[model samples]
Structure formats: C-alpha cells, structure tokens
Target: MITIQDIRNAQENIQDTINATPILQSGQLSQLCRNQVFFKCEHLQKTGSFKIRGATNKVKQVVMEGAKLVTAASSGNHGQAVSFIAQQLGVPATIVVPTDVNPCKMNAIDAYDGNIVKCGTTSAERIPRAIEIAAEQNGLFIPPYDDPYIMAGQGTTGLEILEQVQDVDAVIVPIGGGGLISGILTAIKETNPNIKVYGVEPETANDTFLSFQNGRITSITPTSTIADGLRATQPGDMTFPVMQKYLDDLVLVTDEEIRRAFSVVMERMKQIIEPSSAVTVAALMNKKLPLEGKKVVTVISGGNVDLARISELMIGTERIY
Candidate 1:
C-alpha cells in the first residue's frame, strides 16, 4: 500500500530536480464554469509534464540500486520523462512504445536519447515487452504507474496545489493509468481531508471510471479520441486501490468536450495543453461537476499535442459551431 510517507520521501528526493509548476487562476474558465478555477499547469514542467517528477525519482532510485539499464512502456509522456531523466542521471534507458505511437512523443524520446523499442500498438501489449526487455538486459522496470515512487512523484503536484491555493474546495484531475490521480488524492486527502478530489476521464476512454464502478480492474477497448494520453486500457493494481480510498468522484467527458477545452486553454490562458490534460476543464465547463461558486483546481497534465491535430481540431470546432 502506498502511504503518504512515500509521497513525502519522493518530495525529498525530487525537490531540486523538477519544476514546481504554477497554479494560476483562469479568469475565463472561472467565468464559464461559475467557479474560481485554478489551473495547475504541469504542461509547463520539464519534458512537458508532471511525469518528470516521478520519472526523475524512479530513475534515481533505480540508479542508486546499481541498475544500469531501465525499461518502461509509454505512448509518449512517460517515455519522454523516463528517458530524459535517465539521460540526466547517466543511465541507459529503453522505452517500449507502441509502433503506432504519436510522432510528437516518439520525437521527444529520441530528443532525450532514449533507445526506442517499437512494440505492439496498445499499452496492454507493450507492457509485457518492457518486462521482457527488463529481464533480458537485467534492467529495472519503471512503469508509468503501478510503482510507489512514481505515484509519489505525481503526488508532488497535489502538494504544490495545496500550498498555492487556500481553502480549495475541489481538485479535478485527468485519469489515465491512475498514477497522477493516485498521487494527488493521497496528498490532498492527507493534507486537507475536506477538499473533494475528482477524477476526470474522456468518455471514449473511461477505464478508470469503469474500474472504480466495477470494484476491479476493467479493460476498455480504446476508441478514437483526441485525448491520446487518456487511452490506457486498464488501471494498475496499486493505483486503483489508492484511488478507491481517496477520490471523491469520477466524471466523464466526450472527445468534443475535450477538444473545446483544449482550444479554450490555448485562447484564454494562452497555454498549450493536450486533449487528455483538458478533460478536467472540459468536465467543469460541461456542468458535469457541481462546482459553482467553489474554488476548484484542475491539473492540466501535458502540452504535447501535434501541430496538425490542433489545426484540425480548431477548424473542426469552428465548422461545427
């Protein structure tokens, strides 16, 4: 079980390593949602995500234990994060990514000088390959989530939110593999028990939401969605239990809703955020969560959208309206 102590230890380990991303008030989103909306801009972090916090901590831990090579699987952000951190620490890194993973993320891994092993097209298939590589090469497997260190690294985001916002009523976070929310929930629940922590998922990819409801890990066949980051098929065993204990509720938003929120972040806040990162904002704007007049913080998880996709979404939204 991941205790708050794990997050505290991670905080100590990664204090000087990762950026303490800003928590800024979004006037436009506040007006639209009828709530005081604060955006925890993890998109601005090193490697363009909060993943760096966990990746840094996990890599350091692995390195300290004399692991020369580290292996993991990701579509992009986690891979970039791990690869980049491992390079900084002078450790060999291999990222097992889906052969069809997004070009932007693959470029990010390459930019960090990570060895890319093209695997099958889904995380479910990619995970075994990572494990296999880890076994063959005697490397440590730093999963995107499902590890205590990673969850603690993600919990650092919640720590920043609590320190930045006073008397926050709720925190809305996007859920994929569940590491981010698990960390946030653990931190928030321990620090301020009264604040509600909600997990948001794209309707096209609601594995965590379904898993929470079903009382076990449930798989979903990921459909076409703009939020590529939220396309994980199932939640990890470790993260699901943490979420079950700490999260207040789970909400779902459509792909269109996610795209609109992505556009709004670009236009109003002048910040670039990926569709997966926009799910929390999308939920708030669509009246899916009852947050009127309350102080709510939404974690914008990443900003790594492909330029072509953003153009298509912008033009498509204009045509529809």
Candidate 2:
C-alpha cells in the first residue's frame, strides 16, 4: 500500500519536472451549481495531462537505479506522458497503444521520439504486449496504473488541492483505472477525513462504480464512450482497494452529459478540456451528489482531446447553462 510519505517523496522527486497546476475558482460553474466550485486545472500540466507527474517520477526512479529503457501501455495520455518524460531523462521508451488511439496523442509520442507499437484495443492486450516488449528489450515496464510509484506520484495532485483549497468540502475526480482517484483519495482522506471524495465515470464505462457497489472488484464487457480515457474495463487491483475504502460516493454520467459539460467549460470556463476531464464537470452540472452551497473542487484531468473530433461531439447536444 502507498502511504502519504511515499506520495510526499514522489512530490519531491518530480517537483522540478512537473508543474504544480493552479486550482482556480470557477465563478460560472459555481453559480450554475449553486456552490463555490474550484477547478483543479491539471489540463494545463505538461503533455496536457496529469499523467506526466507519475510517468516522470516512475521513469526518474528507475533511471537513477541504472535503467536504460522503459515501456508502457496507454490509451493516449499515459503513452504521451511516459514518452515525454523518458525523452527528457535521456532514456529510451517504447509505448504500446491501442489500434484506435487518438492521433494527437500518437503524434505527441512520436514528437517525443518514443517507439510506438499498436496492438489490440484493450488494456488486456496492450499491457501484456508492452510487458513482452519490455522483457524482450531488457527494459522496465511502467504500468499506466496499478503500481505504487504511479499512485503515489498522482497523489501529489491531492496535496495541491488540499493546499490550494484549505476548506474544501468535497472533491470530484474522474475514474479510469482508478489511479488518479486512488492517489487523490489517499491524500485527501488521510490529511482530512472530513472532506468528501467522489468518483465519476461515463455510464458506458462504469466499472469503478460497479466495483464500489459490489464490495469487490468487478468488470464489465468492454464498452466505448466519448471519454476514452475513462474506458478501462475494470478498476486496477492496487487502485480498487483504496477507492473502496476512501471514496464517499461513485457517480455515472452519459456521453450526452459529458458533451454538454465539455461545451459548458469551453464557453463559460474558457477551457478546452478532453472528454475524460469533462466527466468531473458533468457530475457537478447534473447534480450527481448533494453539493449545493458546499465548496467543491473538480479536477479537469487533461486537455489532449483531438481537435478534429470536438465539432462532432458538440454538434447536436444542447449546452445547458
């Protein structure tokens, strides 16, 4: 289990490499939600996502211990993050991605000079193939999630949230493999147990919510959603336990709701966030929880959406105020 100290050390390890993204008050969203809402703008972080923090910490730790190469699997953000960090550290990186990965992320990985391998479009296929490649090349495997270092590194966001909003009443985070939420929940609940933590997922990919409700890890048939980053079929083994123990609630949103939220942020918050990031905002706008009049923080986890697809997502959806 990753402890708070591990998270602190991770913060120190990657402090110079990663930016401490700002937590800005979203007056428009606050008024709409009838609460004081703050946005943790992780979308502004390097590589346009918070994945860089964990990727950098993991790569740096291994490189310092004589690692020459590393490999990882990502749908998009994690691949870009690992490749970018590895390039900075002068370590060779190979990234295995799903066959249908977003082109923007693929281009970013190429820009960072990370070797790309396309495999079947599922974590089951991508993870095994990545590990096989790492073994064949005598390189380290940096998991997208399910590792202590990755979780601890991601926990730094929670530390920032607590520092930035001292009296935060609640935090809403999007759930994928549960890495980000696991880290955040650990940091927030350990530091101040009274602060409520909620995890949100697209209705099409609600594995984490199912796991939370079942009292054990559960998986669903692979499904697709606009929030590609949150499409993991199941919660990670390491991350599930932490979420089960710390999350105050788990909520689900539809692709329609995510689209509306995406439009809302772009128009009102003046931020172009990815669909996964919009999940948090969707939760708030849809009133998934009883947060009226409370001080809420929503983590906008990334901004790496393919610009070519934004128009299609917003074409028919009516943006709710």
Candidate 3:
C-alpha cells in the first residue's frame, strides 16, 4: 500500500519537472449542476496529462536504482509521459502500445524520442511485452498503474486537491486502470475522512465498477468508446484494493454524455479537453452523483484530443453513438 508520506516525497521529486496546474472555478458547470465546481486543470500539465506525475517519478526512481533503460505500456497518456520523462533524464525508454491505439498517440510517443514497440491489441497484451522487453534488455518496467511508487506519485494530485479545496464535499475522478482514483482516495481520505470520492467511467468500459462488485479483478470484452483513454480492460491489482477501500461510488456515463461534456468544456469553460478528461464533466452534467449545492472538485485528466476527432465529436455528421 502507498502512504501519504510516499506521495509527499514524490511531490518533491517531480516538482520541478511537472506543473502545479491551476484549479479553476467552472461557473457554467456549477450553474448547470447547481453546485460549486472547481476543475483541477491537469490537462494543462506537462505532456498534456497528469500521467507524467507517476511516470516521471517512476523513471526517476528507476534511474537512481541504476536501471539503464525503462519500459512501459500505455494506451496513450502514459506512453507519452514515460517517453518525455525518460528523454529529459537522458535515460532510454521503450514503449509498447496496443496495435489499435490511436495514431495521434503514436505520433506523440514518436515526438518524445522514445522507442516504440507495436504490441497486442489490449493493455493485457501490451504489459507482458513491456516486461519481456525489460527482461531481455535489462531495463526497468514502469507500469501504468499497479506499482506502489506509481500509485504514490499519482497520489500527489490528491494532495494538491485537498490543499486547494479544504472544504470540498466530493471529488470526482475518471477511472480506467484506477491509478488516479486510487491515489486521490488515499490522499484525500487520509487528510479528511469526510471528503467523498467518486470514480466515473463510460458505461461501455466499466471494468473497475465490475471489479469492485466481483471482489477480484475482472476483464471486459474489448469494446470501443469515444473515451479511449479510459479503455483499460481491467482494474490493476494494487489499484483495485485501494478503490474498494476508499471510493464512495463508481458512476457510469454514456458516449453521448461524454461528448456533450467535451462540448461543455470547450464552449463554456473555454478549455480544450479530451474525451477522457470530459468524463469528470460528464458525470456532473448527467447528475450521476447526488452533488447538488455541494462544493465538488472534478479532475480534468487530460487535454490531448486529436483535432479531427474533436471536429467529429462536435460537428461532423458521422455517428459517434
């Protein structure tokens, strides 16, 4: 289990590399939800996502451990994050991504000067290949989630939330592999047990919710959603238990709802956000939680929406449903 102390240490380790992103009040969203809403603008962080917090901390620790290279598997955010950090530290990185992962994501990895290995079509397949490559080449494996160090690093986001919103009634986070929620829950509940944490996921990609009910990890049959960043097949071993212990609820949103949230963010908040980031907005817009009139904080996870995809989500005639 990761502790608050570990999170504090990570905050210090990666402070210079990562941004203390702004937390902005979303008046439009608040008016719509009839609640006080503050958006943690992590989408504006380095590499355009909060994943860098964990990836940088993980790679920095590995380099101190005398690892010559680092390996990782990601859908998009984590791959870009690890690659960027590895290059910054002058350490080599190899990223194994699912074959069907987005081309824009691949381009981002390519831009970071990281080695890319095309692997299986799911995170389940990609992770094993990362491990294999690490073993074959004597490199360290930087898991997207499931590692104590990674979890602790991600928890620093929660610490920031608490510091910014000491009287927060609820914190909403989007869930994929559960790292973000796990870290936030650990940090928030430790400081204020009264703060409620909600995990939001697409209805088509609700692996963590199912895992919470099953009392074990569960994999979803492969399905596609607009929120590709939240498309993990299952909950991670380390993240599952933390969520089960700390999360107040797991809510599901539809693809349409997610797109609407994307539009709301762009139009109302004047902020560019990706689908995965919009999951937090989607939950509030759909009233998935009982958060009327309460002070709520929503973690805007990323802002890496492909321009073409954004056009399609907002105005294109193609069916996203």
Candidate 4:
C-alpha cells in the first residue's frame, strides 16, 4: 500500500525534474456551476502531461540502482514520458505501443530516441510484448500506472493542488488505468480526509466506474472513444484498491460530452487539452457530481493532441456561450 511518506519522498525525488503546474480559477465555469472552479493545469506539465512526474521518479530510482536499460508500454502519453525521461537520464529505453496510438505521441517518442515497438491494440498485447523485450534486454520494466513509485510520483499533483487551492471541497480527476487518481486520492485523503475526490471516465471506457460500482476489479471489452488515453480495459492491481478505498464516486461521460468539454476549454479557457483530460470537465458540465456552492478542482491531465483531429471532434458540438 502507498503511504503519505512515499508521496512526500516522491515529491522530493522529482522536485527539480517536474513542473509545479499552476492552479487557475475558471471564471466562466465558476459562473456556470455556481461554484469556485479551479483547474490544475497538468496539460502544461512536461511532456504535455502529468505522466512525466511518475516516469522521471521511476527512471531515477532504477538508474540510481545501476539500471542501464528500461522498458515501458503505453498507448501514447506514458510511452513518451518514459522515453523522454529515460533518454535524459542516459538510460536506454524501449517503448511498446498499440498500433492505433496517436501519431503525435508516436512522433514524440521517436524524438526522445526511444526504440519503438508496435504491437496489437490493447494493453494485453502491448504489455506482454514490452515485458518480453525488457527480459531480452535485461532491463527494468516501468508499467504506466501500476507501480508504487509511479503512484507516489503522481501524488505530487495532489500535493500541489492542496497548496494551490485552499478550502477545496472536491477534486475531480480523469481515470484510465487509475494511476493519477490513485496518487491524488492518497495525497488528498490522507492529508485532508474531508475533501472529496471524484473520478471521471469516458462511458465507453468505464472500467474504473464499473470496478467502483461492482466493489471489485471489473473490466470491459476495449472500446474506442475520443478520450483515447482512458482506454484501459481494467484498473491496475495496486491502483484499484487505493481507488476503492478513497474515491468518493466515479462518473461516466459520453464521447459527445467529452468533445463538448474539449471545445469549451479551447474556446473559453484558451487551453488545449486532449479528450482524456477533458472528461473531468465533462462530468462537471453535465452535472454528474454534486458541486453546488463548493470549491472544486478539476485536473486537466494532458494536452498532447493531434491537431488534425480537432476539427473532426468539434464538427457537431455547439460551443458553450
């Protein structure tokens, strides 16, 4: 189990390496929701996502232990984060990704000089392939969301949120394999148990939601959504229990709702966030959570988007006025 001390140590471990992202109040959203809305701008974080904190922390630990090579599997963001951080730390890295991963993320991994290996279109395929490669190369395997180090590293964001927003009544975060929310839940609940932490996910990729509802780890057949980063078939072994223990609620939003949230953030907030990052906002806008007259923090998890897809996503959605 992850402890508060582990999160604090992770903060110290990646203090200089990670960005302390700003928490900005969204005036328009506040007016709409009748609550003080603060957005943790993790999209502005290194590698255009919050994955860097965990990736850097894990890489640092392994490299200090004389690890010369590392391997990871990601749909996109985690792959880029692991590759970039490993390259910077002088540890050779290999990243296995699904063939359907976003092109922009693929390009970023290549730019980081990570050896790219392509596999089938699910974690089941990508993970085993990457593990095989890691064994062959005698390298450490860095899972995207399952490791304790990764969870602790991601907890730093929650620490920042607490420092940045006072009297925060609730924090809404998007969930995939449950890493980010797991860390945030640990940090926030351990420090201030009164503060509620809710998780959001695309309706199509609602593994975490089902897991939360069923009182056990549950999985869905992998489905496609605009929130591609949140396509995990199931929650991580380490992350699920943490989430079940601390998460106040789990909400699901449709792809259309996510796209609408993405459009609003881009046009009104002037922020470029990927679909996965927009799910929290989608939950808020759809009133899926109880946020009336409260101070709410929404985590904008990533901004690495393929520009060409924006027009397609926004085609039928009307802008929030």
**Which parts of model 3 have CA positions greater than 4 angstroms off?**
315-321
TM-score of 3: 0.96
Model 1 lDDT per residue over 1-321, tens place: 677788889999998889989887877679988999999999999999889999988899989989999998998999999999899988889999987788888999999999999987778888899999999999989999889889999998998899999999999999999999999999999988999999998887889888878999999985667788777899999999998888899999998887788777777778888888989988998999877999999999998878766776652436322
lDDT of 1 at 267: 77
Candidate 4 per-residue C-alpha lDDT over 22-68 given as tens digits, one digit per residue, 9 for 90 to 100: 98777888887678889999999989999999998899999999999
Q: Native-vs-model 1 lDDT?
A: 0.88
**Cα-lDDT of candidate 2:** 0.91
What is the per-residue lDDT of model 2 for residues 1-321, given as tens digits with 9 covering 90 to 100? 788888999999999999999987768789988899999999999999999988988899899999899999999899999999999989999999999999999999999999999998778779999999999999999999899999999999999998998799999999999889999999999999999999999999988888877888898987889999988989999999998788899999999889998988887777889999999988999998988999999999999989899887773424475
Model 2 clash pairs are none
Give the per-residue lDDT of model 3 (tens digit) for 1-321: 788888999999999999988899867679987899999999999998999999988999999989899999998889999999999999999999988777787889999998999887778888999999999999989999888888888889999998887689999999989888888998999888899999999999999988878878999987789888888999988899899889899999999888888887777778988899888888988889988999999999998777767777763223221
Candidate 1, residue 156: Cα displacement in angstroms equals 0.7
Q: Give Cα-based local distance difference scores for all models.
A: 0.88, 0.91, 0.88, 0.91
Question: Can you list the residue pairs that collide in candidate 4?
Answer: none
Worst 10 residues of 4 by lDDT: 312-321
RMSD of 1: 1.5
Better of 1 and 2 by lDDT: 2
Q: After superposition, how far is residue 268 of candidate 1 from its true place, in Å?
A: 1.1
